[model samples]
Target: MQNPAAATSASEFAELPATASHGPLRIEYRWVNETACDAPIAVFLHEGLGSISMWRDWPQALCERLGMRGLVYSRPGYGLSTPRPHDVKWPVDFMTAQARDILPALLDALDIDLPERRSMWLIGHSDGGSITLLYAALHPDALAGAVAIAPHVFVEDISVESIAQTKQLYETTDLRAKLGRYHADVDSAFYGWNDIWLNPAFRDWTITSELAPIRVPLLAVQGHDDNYGTMAQIDTIADCVPHAELVKLDGCGHSPHRDAPQALNEAIAAFVSKQK
Candidate 1:
């Protein structure tokens, strides 16, 4: 059953100043139940190819059920935010950059005082999931807990194969057009992610060692039929994070929120409730 408290209160933009290496960016973001000022905040990190609009109402629904405020935003190059330059290629450590630099900058710009208040909760999907893990690892004390949905801890052969197939689809099918609806510059969003993941050098990327330092509660969810990765991804998270919980959903693939939204929402709400 879906929660009836699902309601988005506002959508806005945060203008981020240019950093040493990158230009200024306008981030499109939305807030759910902003009036719940005393409640813990839950930030939603979209997938690699996703945008603020792409998340639809899932963040609102989840925040409503948890009685928490919600923050959903489009990363640079995705949605209404600043688009990636055409000639620029993302580095192999792009996700790390997001976790280390971009996310913190955004939070600071938004006046989110992480250190003073309780650490915020994070709900991340796909690439966002990996970013969430990296952020939690890098700043173990800045997060209350996290939920990683279909996150990649390490690159797998299947991941490369599926990403390659997506590249073909983007080239040959209406995938580009469909994605364009979500991004101001579709190629920036697509190639930025696709190019890096398919790069040979990225094959060695892994956050397994980084996971050992994470001390917060973590719930790792994955689909049994996920084409992009196997159960090893979440299983490894369990092995590294002490008492990390795992949820394996049957009849789902790559995206549990899309495939099993109700179950995902209920599970997350229950897990978060326990933390409180």
Candidate 2:
């Protein structure tokens, strides 16, 4: 409740036409400061199991701080986007695939052009943070800057342990019902992320080596109290991308945006300002 927004953004669905990689997804999204014609755009990437609504007013609050246009959306298998079929299990490189394929497709579907992309910034959290880094590495010139909060570049024991616990909570607690308020197909969203994370093959997954090519201004953040990961996540990012700036919030958790929104906003705003 500390982070507040005066603007009331609204959501709309963008219908992505079929692409060779994957498509025809109906993505629910919201725009902030859409009428700010000359301002740079900030496209938000939600965390794994996150959606447009799950973001709450934080995106709006941040965009207002930076005086930038913003776009927030639900990924294909989550939120109000086309839900994943029950039989389909996500591949190990699903996050990368989203950065490489789905994001660009969504931007195209929304008529965001190369010029706009060059001025855009990606603000992602958790799994969305991973996607932001992947996108930066894969398409360096496509965006002006990026902020990755609590991104995982490699699979860690703590990550697996926490995820396993989350799976148990999902099954035994009211977590499903809680998340259902944000996702259209709660089971599809929950299982799609949970099953793949718990899969044995996912233990060897790592994207730490793939970040050498990212040239955009990047800010990597993590909370000291995060149950889902450790400071090593952002430290490893600094190791891979030497130019990256890091922010470690002491009293925060897995979701820095929720735990320390003001600090997160200040870090991002300062990072982007330096880029300018």
Candidate 3:
């Protein structure tokens, strides 16, 4: 509703195939409220290279555990959504675009009006985590709370170097093949994200200043063994928002949902249940 032009950017795919129409992109989302009990909505935001398929069934389990309806979707150029323009690379303000424009448009197309007492809870991982922070900061009242796992608040040399390694793996190994299993068009999703982060302008990306505006309760988690980000990311978040809590997982890497499902799920369930 906010940016009609951005919302309709993917309109050509509207007549394409099987997918949920969120704006012009086809978002794959699963809704399960079998309990018929009134509960809050939990929006699950995937990692940079993640999609609904990559999330597997974790979202469903979390929703059932907490008795909340869940919303999960792939952004444009990912999963079942439309492919991105090949020549277009992600800009330095990519996160800002997602927060100020794309996310709101998606919510509008979904026909969801913000509730008063308990707003939608966000569970975001990695890039989704950063975008969640951005969204929470901009529309603090729209969220009940949020849980971010291994979110990046600032870009570091380690991340860029690691991403470079990943690019090599994508070309030399079966990494792209593995991604193919989860994405309908793995290249679109992969390149759209990978190239943006690797862009020269992306090296200085930081959302800490924006995060200070977040008024909702937050729970941030990071793996001790996470190769993607440093503890400073969550540390900065807690520093910025006094109400934020940080959890450090041991023996875990980037994908905490898969590596430590029980712990992650339990923590999230507890956090969402306690939301007021």
Candidate 4:
């Protein structure tokens, strides 16, 4: 895999030298299969602690399989994008703001045309998956289809416990050094997500009611073995959106794209084909 924002590649860094504006934040993004303009556009949203490099090549593989162009980007405070201010804590509504504000602005900055947006499909994982649900709910007309992999609609005890444990791993182990390969400011990426989830006030966070407005073709997917959350996350999604379909993968952990790529890709391709 090409080192994503790794220390080794000055040429790779040069390729993504420009930044897009999402208000005060400078966002870094990369295009996959840009030449395939005839196909629909697939925009990938990474997990809470993820960046563009963390996604590796799954975006390309899935986009090729579905005959779509892909957009993969690092969120502000992650990857080569603008780092979050050390003193600032992400608000509970941060994911909502991403769906409502930052994503739209990034698309605008990229100058993706309306025709592309009209034929857009969003594929998001973990925290990004929740953001996808929010985007579809808020802008029902904006998407052709959406696939949310391992999304959290509401905070759970297991989720908190896992995140807290991850904090310990980050502090006491080489997790930070490992993640440093993908992000310019690993702490900005890690703490922005960690601080908020572990906050006592954030325990009450849930988008269950907000999910009712999602009118786009939707798929809620999760691995049966996901340690961070239970199947109830997607189960709750199905309850809110009557039309939403669910996929539960066995022998898979949190990262389905890596753990069960063929299964996830096939499910997504089949789901998108029906959209046409």
**Candidate with best lDDT:** 2
Please list the residue runs of candidate 3 whose C-alpha ends up more than 4 Å from where it truly belongs after superposition.
1-24, 33-37, 116-118
How do all the candidates rank in terms of TM-score, highest first?
Answer: 2, 1, 4, 3
Cα lDDT for residue 201, candidate 2: 96
Predicted candidate 2 versus true structure: per-residue lDDT over 1-276, tens digit per residue: 011143455667889888776757888887876666577889899888899998888988888889898889999988888999999999999999999999998888778889889999999999999999999999998999999999999999999999999999999999989999999899999999999999999999999999999999999999999998999999999999999999999899999889999988888888888877
Model 3: how far is 33 from its true place, Å?
A: 4.2
Candidate 4 positional error at 187, Å? 0.7
Model 4 RMSD vs true structure:
4.7
TM-score of model 1 (CA atoms): 0.94
Top TM-score: which candidate number? 2
- Estimate the Cα RMSD of every predicted model relative to the unseen true structure: 3.6, 3.7, 6.2, 4.7
Model 1 bad stretches (over 4 Å) = 1-10, 115-117
TM-score (all chains, Cα) for each model? 0.94, 0.96, 0.88, 0.92
Name the Cα RMSD for model 2: 3.7
Model 2 C-alpha lDDT versus the unseen true structure: 0.89
The TM-score between candidate 2 and the true structure equals 0.96
Better-scoring candidate (lDDT), 1 or 4: 1
Q: Which pairs of residues collide in model 3?
A: none
Ranked candidates, highest lDDT first: 2, 1, 4, 3
